[model samples]
Target: MSKLFRAVIMGPPGSGKGTISERIAQSFGLKHLSSGDFVRENIAAKTEAGVQAKTYIKKGLLVPDLVMTRLLLPRLEEMTKYSWLLDGFPRTLAQAEALNSACDLDVAINLNIPLETLKERLRHRWIHPPSGRVYNMCFNPPRIQGIDDITGEPLIQQEDDRPEALVARLRHYKDVAKPVIDFYKAKGILYTFSDTETDQIWPNISTLLSTKIPTIQSDARCASTH
Candidate 1:
């Protein structure tokens, strides 16, 4: 049987994990799964897990570990036949341990972006809600200010990306993610990239994965046009 490469990406908001993940998925053949997407899907489908999560969300409470694990694990099981890249799943130490027990991870990529850079990037970030298309003022601005490029709908910044909420989110992410990073480090498969732009970090990440997995070529580049 062919080997399966399971990878998890860890980064704070506005760290370009999504862009890098898409490049990796396109360059290689790994299935890409985003935890946020999973929750959104379940909630839209009104599944049991979604209903339970919605109850907690409506009450202004975080979803329990049990519910998160129950909701995410089945999705992984369905992808047992393919190598996959996961984003935003194991946010806490408990989630990391749970994931460890479920499957072996080949590598865990940590993006160590500067706080100021993250703040600047996210502050300028706006999205098209219906399609989840993100546009950054500094990097890729839309044709019109505060407008979606594709649909021409008004774009709005996410509440969490706003200055007031960004500080708290970054603090919480650092606190919860340290142990998870340490865990992967101990396992000897932790590869970290520190940069201000996704383009700067993509080459190193591409090189690392290419070295670790024989499915890709070392000379491959994630094009800016993507």
Candidate 2:
């Protein structure tokens, strides 16, 4: 069997982490595990940790780090047999430490988009909340302006996406993410890609993974055969 590869992608909102993560999962044949989706699933299923998390979420409070670790670590344990890419967990230094204690990470991909570019992209963004479909006016606009393509429903911009709110959010993200980035950097597994567009960054990430994945997998395969 090939060696299992584990990675995490980190970026502020509007940095295209979702799109990049999806592409990485598709290109590398790694399972994409989204922390947000997993939390929602557990909440829907009424798991103990999820029930505890939902209480904090309902009170407009961030879930405690212990709850988050409890919710996330077991999910990682289950993915032991396959390579996987984790997205949207470990938003703080405490959580990062919890994750460090749980498993060794092979890579930590960081997106370093310019502030102006992130603002521009987010300002033109709209969403169909019911279906969770996102549309960007500058690039991937709907067929009719301000309308959902399939449902023709009027789209709404999230208040959090507004420039005023975005600045504060980005500031918070930078503060929270710095320690985690430093932690990974110290481990020599952090790769940061800076660009105005996701397309420009994709090729570089693809090249890095192509080199890293095959070499490790081949070595593991050779050892297994012996």
Candidate 3:
């Protein structure tokens, strides 16, 4: 079979795109390539593109499309040798067109969560700084009050999680990201999952993965794995 299972997960911040993508990647044997994480990794390695990106990043400015494209293209090319799921890139129409020209995505999964629900969910959000483990006091709180369940460290709220900042970010996301979503929709490759809750959403996602990637479902431990 051709090693060409490429997917992109898109949603506003705090919409559970990351969590859902992680679950899908692990369950389906797809490499999870998060663009934000990838850029950070590159910066850590001090690669040429990373060095270019850091100049903007350190200045608290977004990396230009050309530079980000340079940084991401190689990673996407490498993943074409195997199955992979991409997250957090193509935030603009130009970037989406560029990425499609380079490596056409097979699927674009959109996590559609209501703004009110997201605002409420993020209100209770806390995190472990070192491990980046997130806790939501509303639904998925840690076992210990204001502490990480795995470690006894106190949780901290992210600056971006603040109500005002989140609202601005989501507005920007909706404005800038709609074109990317429409591009995929026109191609008939976009899928939306209403992310009200993980439990309600996972069954549909699991079933889709099973039907789309049968090799993953054949695992005897697949049922227990989730």
lDDT of each: 0.86, 0.88, 0.80
109-155, model 1: which lDDT tens digit per residue? Answer: 99999999999999999988666677899888999999898888899
Clashes of each: 0, 0, 0
Model 3 lDDT per residue over 157-220, tens place: 8777788988888888899899999999999989889957877887887887666665433442
lDDT of 3 at 220: 29
Better of 1 and 3 by TM-score: 1
Off by over 4 Å in 1: 55-62, 142-154, 215-226
Worst 10 residues of 1 by lDDT: 216-225
Q: What is the overall TM-score of model 1 with all chains considered together?
A: 0.87
CA displacement after TM-score superposition, residue 146 of candidate 1 (Å): 4.5
lDDT of 1: 0.86
**Which prediction has the highest lDDT against the true structure?**
2
Off by over 4 Å in 2: 55-61, 128-133, 142-156
- Displacement of residue 87 (Cα, Å) in model 3 is 1.0
lDDT of 2 by residue, 46-163 (tens): 9999899899867645688899899999999998898988888788889999988988888899999999999999999898765556789987899999999999999999878899
Better of 1 and 2 by lDDT: 2
What overall lDDT, based on C-alpha atoms, would model 3 receive against the true structure?
A: 0.80
